[model samples]
Target: MGWLQSLFSPLKKLWFRLHSAPKKRRGIYILYEDVKSCPYEDVHVLWSILVESHTLRTKV
Candidate 1:
């Protein structure tokens, strides 16, 4: 089980990168709202990236 985790650890970073915000903008950010604790940012980078990507696609 531990070996499996190690093998997939790098994927986490890649996933975050693929889902993170663009390097040129700041209006887009991932917001994480957790009632269990407090509203905070969790995937800001990822959210921004995704939103920008979608916007670009829609424009096409």
Candidate 2:
């Protein structure tokens, strides 16, 4: 029994090495910065254009 256990000790060590607890402190987070003109400017312009047309146009 002792010899059998000793024979499998290397396998047990290998399994523990493979399934060890993860070290989460070894991670990285990359941040990015961006600068651009607003894309929604067209939405506000369309709303104003529709309002101006509503005032000038005729309705039934």
Candidate with maximal lDDT: 1
Error of 1 at 38 (Å): 44
Q: Give all TM-scores, in the order shown.
A: 0.37, 0.34
lDDT of 2: 0.59
lDDT of 1 by residue, 1-60 (tens): 999999999999999999998675344332323222444455555655777897998799
lDDT (CA) for every model shown? 0.65, 0.59
User: What TM-score does candidate 2 get on C-alpha atoms?
Assistant: 0.34
Candidate 1: misplaced stretches above 4 Å?
A: 25-60
Clash pairs for candidate 2: none
List residue ranges in candidate 2 displaced over 4 A: 23-60
Summed backbone clashes in each candidate are 5, 0
Residue by residue across 3-47, what tens digits does model 2's lDDT show? 999999999999998899965442111111111233566755665
